[model samples]
Target: MDDDRERLTSKPETSDPLPKAEHPWVETLKTIGLSVVLALGVRSFVADSRYIPSGSMLPTLQINDRLIIDKLSYRFSDPVRGDIVVFHPPAQLERELVANGEKKFQEAFIKRVIGMPGDRVEVKGGKVYINGKVLAENYLGEPPRYQWSSTELTPDGIVPPSHYLVLGDNRNNSYDSHYWGFVPQDKVIGKAILRFWPINRAGGITPQPDYNN
Candidate 1:
């Protein structure tokens, strides 16, 4: 039976030889290309990861702390106070960076939302007040010590429509909306869902506030 089976399968003639090497390489290339595309699509639309770069979010997020962001959430619900977020640098901050000749990763910055759209916020006497109430920022390593200067966004400001006032939990150290401006809704990339770095601190991030709207 083995001899008969071997005789039944004939080799290709010289005139009709198959291009064996090319087919394997082409298939491998196509597979690799598809995999890359799929990965990028998932990262852009489904979810992505980021690491804490500064002490702004200290006490909550430490430098080099990695996070998994939920890019899908903001599509359905708006950001709320207390939720940690990742967003592209606002235009004002970007311009300042360029003018100063600084070279930093031009990626998004992460911070905790302090005020939602239309909320009145003021930082004075070393405290952050939102909607006439001081933010109970238990996550801070210390009370906000830096006063928001006139050049900053305080002195009782109203958050613009489709924007949010975000600050680092490390209020005194973070360069956030206080130094720039509100994070436009369009520039928001996602909600910080979990922290998966530094081993012992592996857990969910600060929960999002329950907003009526």
Candidate 2:
């Protein structure tokens, strides 16, 4: 009976609650803080979101289409032909006109890389031929599309070293390399890799092929 009584009186073993589980508020704040940091990191380094503002890149990128730009690519290698990219305007343009009367230097524009350094690009008879070979473009939407005016390089316009010549998929509306000039390599901001908005139309964009050069 004494042994039974002693055993009953002895304290039972118990586990301390899980390492003082963090307070709900503290956990919530930590999660929020981490998310903000991650977002900023993505915006600055990995990827960023942008909206199409004009018809310049139409057929492939429509007006108001939201896209996710891949910021990690150019860090390791140079952009290639047919990769759609975003870049700043050239310096020769009038600042006031380019900024559109805005106070800040708004220089971001999106277009497809049609020519790279040392490439010979030309438009003839409504078709784009590079280095004497015709290019196959499967992205242009319909049969009634307006092809840009045929123009040939008066002189061999070598794509400047470390620069790319870009064009809008909508040949008639875009103000791209044909109108202005090549985009300096340093000015390329990123590549538009995916379209994430509008649930019904969400998918990755396949970069166009470049014929053997």
Candidate 3:
């Protein structure tokens, strides 16, 4: 009887083995959540892609052209003339757009840097002159069809420190700095570096060739 009692009282062998397969749905949801978080983080802090929605950069960037913007490089260096960039519109321009029935105002403007801070800029007689030198801009899909009659906008004034002047390739009709004002250096988001969509034009986006040389 004592032997029987000892055998019966012996602690049952512990069988706490973890399940071989985790709850399948729980793992799937976790994986999806992680993927989404990683994608958003990369987009916000690394690089971002945007689609060209207008002809402002025609012949170079077409409508629906997919571009990969280099958000990282600008952190190490300031924008240079000829670098294509995307930036937020100035506050006054935003207000104007909203008041003009564009309640859901478009996000940002893309243009090429034509002048940097402290540089003199002038546009007259169908040519853009920088610091008294006529800039040779051959990238314009079409010639600048409008002449600036305003003295304040003439290449006469020096670009403000920490500001840049930009213009679209489609100079004749683009709603850009010429229509508004300078893009503050800090407002610049990133330089456009590549055209990844529309297959035919997929390649490295070129900065305007240096004209100073």
Candidate 4:
């Protein structure tokens, strides 16, 4: 009877075991993967960084200058004149490259918006004109050395709907719309918002004061 009592009072040794702790390395890998995914998501839809690779935007963006590109703004509104923008090569340029037998690749180009839909753009006598009025440009490195007329560059003497004329601040040296053609609205990637590198010159890329006057 005492033995029976002892067996009744004792806990069973065959009870279920506690769950095993996960390996430390397994947890570490999970954290790393989550961080990578978050970074990629932000770059794709929120904002991203870019560095100037040439003097095309000189005096405004020097070679090797790093900038923050805002990819969200254009989704809410259309790009306006004087906004620095980055975009993919347009179809016209792609066809030319293909004709030259060059390697096919997508590269982003940076330039400032100069003409909007329905606007007439003309470059002559060291000045840019929009709709017959001379543009007030205080940021150009120097006057454009080349001449361009809307009638000569486009099918009509005005910017087509959903197209933008882009040019480099370093007008004389840039390979821009005057050389190739208009940038389709859909090809634009984003507006350049800030310069973050070369700390002495770091600041917002402010839009030029309204030149429509």
The lDDT leader among the candidates is 4
Question: Residues 30-141, candidate 1, lDDT per residue (tens digit)?
Answer: 9999999999999989999888877778888888999999999999999888989899987888887888897785678888998888788777777777666666666778
Model 1 gets an lDDT of 0.81
Worst 10 residues of 4 by lDDT: 204-213
TM-score of 4: 0.86
User: Per-prediction TM-score, please?
Assistant: 0.78, 0.76, 0.84, 0.86
lDDT for model 2: 0.77
TM-score of 1: 0.78
Q: Which has the better TM-score: candidate 1, or candidate 4?
A: 4
List candidate 4 segments past 4 Å from native. 1-20, 99-101, 104-106
Clash pairs for candidate 3: 121-155, 122-155
Model 2: residue 79 alpha-carbon error in angstroms: 1.2
Q: What is the C-alpha lDDT of each candidate?
A: 0.81, 0.77, 0.81, 0.90
Candidate 3: where are CA atoms >4 Å away?
A: 1-20, 149-156
Minimal lDDT window, size 10, model 2:
142-151
- Alpha-carbon error at 126 in model 2, in Å? 0.5
- Tens digits of per-residue lDDT, candidate 3, 134-204, equal 77877777778676522365455777888888888888868877777788888888999998897887988
Backbone clash count for every predicted candidate, in the order shown: 0, 0, 2, 0
Q: How far is candidate 1 from the true structure (C-alpha RMSD, Å)?
A: 6.1
Cα error, candidate 4, residue 71 (Å): 0.6
